[model samples]
Target: MSSAFEVRGGNRLKGEIIPQGAKNEALQIISAVMLTSEKVTIHNIPDIVDVNLLIELLGDAGVKVNRISRDKCEFQADDIDLAYLQGADFKKKSGRLRGSVMIAGPLLARFGKALIPKPGGDKIGRRRLDTHIIGFEKLGARFNYESDDNYFRLEAPGGLKGTYMLLDEPSVTGTANIVMAAVLAQGTTTIYNAACEPYLQQLCKMLNSMGARISGVGSNLLTIEGVTSLGGCQHTMLPDMIEIGSFIGLAAMTQSELTIKNAGVESLGIIPEKFRSLGIQLEIKGNDIYIPSQETYEIQTFLDGSILTIADHPWPGFTPDLLSIVLVVATQAKGSVMIHQKMFESRLFFVDKLIDMGAQIVLCDPHRAVVIGLGRQHPLRGITMSSPDIRAGVSLLIAALSAEGKSTIQNIDQIDRGYQYIDERLRNLGADIKRV
Candidate 1:
């Protein structure tokens, strides 16, 4: 049954949830192995099913990976068994993972070429690789369709070179491809208007530490100077910002106070202010944030004092992935907030489940929803529903906890992809939930 999570709902959760390494960052960082043959040590790595699958994928392809500790690992790609990457079993397992697509550029970098099948992830919307493909093409790579096998063969004819490339959109995978390609190119490469999310920045940092010359670390304009080789470097992954954000929403929804440690507040620029518009109180303590239990909160309206709207953008703005969680948190606040998800057409469809639970939300369109914070409107009672994606599953979980009755969340595998043992972690904070 695709692995479901049955969450018994209607519990006030109060506890400390330690953040794990960022999944998005980990995927990219691990893929960087193709740039060198050194033994790379990554600390603060998240132990999740997806990352495990990625490691298995790496090991299956002949990379030596070892678990040095709970949050640390060692990777050496000197002996990748490229020939073994074929076959149905490999394709099937890789198809189950979204990050598998990320390996193309690295594999090409490591072995002059890559044969990759179509990758998979949450059924969010159309995720095209035109940007990624074009980036590779600009660097001397030629692509051909392997129609019978449902795969793409990208081969660098005379090796990669530095070039000026513009992405159609600030695609994260595209940026990663360019970053990996640039690491081994013969000259300098300039990427304009790239996706500069904190996770992406972390990847750049790790790559730079490994001897790749990359400038403009936290900006849209990235300048990478291709080096002949990169040595192994030790890097500690940052705490999961999404997890911190989730906790912020959780604390506000159930009127529970929480002090989140090592939230990397600098990396969360504008996020706090963004949450404040929804009346979420946050007290910053160096790198930590203290969320006080509140009895009443309201979403701020327009500057002229009209109903306000919160929307998603590429980066340095609201992440589209978090829009679902924002929708649920808005339901507990005491005002109205419009959620405009510009990227994905069907992301707002999940709100129908919220509505079924008596939430005061109006699905304005396929991409927009108006959430009227019910305060205590119909208090979500226990219900059973299937998780749709990674973020959606966790948002549903937070909503279920705020509801007054018992609820069971099916399809928990989605939640496991991003968050680590969410039920067990929340239970430590006083939540009433049992996964059966």
Candidate 2:
């Protein structure tokens, strides 16, 4: 059964909240556990649906999973059932999860063969698997796609041989997948235009700890010296930067005072500044973010006095995931700003729902929108809406929390896939929200 959130808007939430572990990082790191047969322990795993489902999938594949706690688990893939990969159960479960694609790189590297169903996740835009498939082919893996059942079969009968490759785009998952596959190859592999997100860096660091030689972790160029095998290692995920960004936007939208605890500020790289550009005041004190309540905030124009435009780029640039949050927060600001969602075509479509809630917004195109701050002159009115994706779902929730009267948000499962105990956490911060 699907869930919905009934939100009574116009509540000034105030409290301290800790973000869950990084969701993107957890997916890569958990998948990396399969690269080693020895026991691997992961700490700070998010209790979200997607991560939990990946864990369950691993368990079903003959890996021994011991849950140390709600946020910690140990994985040992010593006796993986390779036959399960071709079974209906694996196809059905993996098809529902996009993260399941990452498992292919590890499985192919460690076991010489792997199969994956066409993965599924957010419908924000076109997410191509070309980077992954091409990288695997470069590493001596030949793959064939079964169009009938939407499955991919990859094999390296002679073992993988590493080679230099340049990615057309700096895709985070693509980089992680290629890097994981390259780690166990027979020779040196150099990857240019690789994604250098903090999560990716953490994956490299964890791989290094597990006896793999990887360098250029925090940069776009990565060099890996392939090892014959990898061992187990413990890794703790960084705090979710997307969630931290969401909290900052949430505090500003509801005119609430909120303190986000242990936000991993250094890894946030440019996220805090991006929120500040919208005139949201935030203080970074000892890795925590403090957002003060304000009756109104103004948007900052460019130095040349042009309308400020926020566009998504690869890491070190603003993340694409938080663009929805930024767009929603701008609805009540004091000036105009253009949100250029350059990465995904459909991300800006959610602005229509914001417009329905009395937000002053103009959908310029599929990839862009201009938001004219309401200046608090006219408060947004609550309305019923369906969440389009994970990021947009949270964006709508933020809008509903700041609007007048009550709002019903359907498809909250999308929200739960990314956020952990969101409604319960919001309740702790005095938000008048409940799950139905």
Candidate 3:
């Protein structure tokens, strides 16, 4: 059943909140469990819809899943039903999860064959699988797409042979997928222009612990020395940096004082600085981030006095995932700023909903939007809106919380896909929101 969030706006939420495990990291790490027959223990798994759905799919693949706790689990893929990969149920489930594609690399590497349905998630833009497919082909895997059921089949008849390849783009999932495949391939593999996000780094570290020989973890150029087999290992996920960034935006938007606990501050490269550039005052104490209630915040301009522009880049840069939060937070700041969403063309489309709520945002194009801050002088008035994607859903939720009147947000399932018990968490923080 579809649900909506009924938010009574203008509530200054206060209290501390801890972010869930990194969703992106959880997806990759959980999928890596398929690489070994031994038991792999994972900690800090997010109890979100998408992650849970992936776990369910894994269970259906004949993996032994022990639910150790809400945030932890153990997986043993010793008896995987390889035939299940081509079943109708697998197609239906995996097709709905974009992260399901990552499982192919592990399955192919371990079992010499894999099949994945056309994966789906947020309809942000054209998230191509070419990087993954091409990388696998370079590793000596034969690829075939069956249009009848929309499944991509990969087979390594003679097992995978490692080779050097440069990625066209530093796709996070693509890099992780290729790395997982190359880790068990025969001989050496060198990947240039690989994604070096903290989550990817975590995956590499975990794979190494499992006996996979991989080096150059935190750098774009990765060298993998293939090992005959991998063993079981325990890995813990970092706090979701995107969620941490969202909390900073939320505190600034509602003029609320919030402390985000166990934020994994060290791994959050450039996220804090990006939020700070928006003039949101935040203090890092130990591992927690303290954001004080602010009457108003201003946007920082460039050194040349030009209008500030916030754009997304690969790791070590502002993440594209949080650009929606940044755009929504910029709506009520004390200055004008340009939000350049270079990665996904449709990401900036959610600004129209904010504009309807009285935020002065100019939709320049599909990729860029100019936000003129209301400065809290003219507070936004609430209205009914629908969530288009996960990040945009949370962005709208933040805008609705800061608006003047009651706001109704439909399609809340999108929000639930990424956030773990978000409504309950916000309620604990004094937000006047409820599910309907």
Ten residues in sequence with the least summed lDDT for candidate 1: 3-12
Candidate 3 runs further than 4 Å off: none
Q: Please report, in order, the local distance difference test score of every candidate based on alpha carbons.
A: 0.83, 0.94, 0.94
In candidate 1, which residue pairs clash? 4-411, 4-412, 5-412, 7-409, 9-407, 14-429, 15-429, 382-405, 382-406
> Which pairs in model 2 have colliding backbones?
none
Which lDDT tens digits does candidate 3 get at residues 1-436?
A: 7999999989899999999999999999999999999999999999999899999999999999999998999999999998888788888889999989999999989989988777699989888999999999999999999998888989999999999999999999999999999999999999999999999999999999999999999999999999999999999999999899999999999999999999999999999998899999999999999999999999999999999999999988889999999989998898999999999988888888998999999899899999999888898889999999999999999999999999999999999999999999999999999999
TM-score of each: 0.97, 0.99, 0.99
Error of 1 at 59 (Å): 0.7
What TM-score does candidate 3 get on C-alpha atoms?
A: 0.99
Which segments of model 1 are wrong by more than 4 Å?
A: 2-10, 86-88
Please give, for residues 83-137, the per-residue lDDT of candidate 2 as tens digits. Answer: 9976889999999999999999999898899887775999888888999999999
What stretches of model 2 exceed 4 Å from their correct place?
Answer: none
If ranked by lDDT, best first, what sequence of candidates would result? 2, 3, 1
The CA-based lDDT of model 3 is what? 0.94
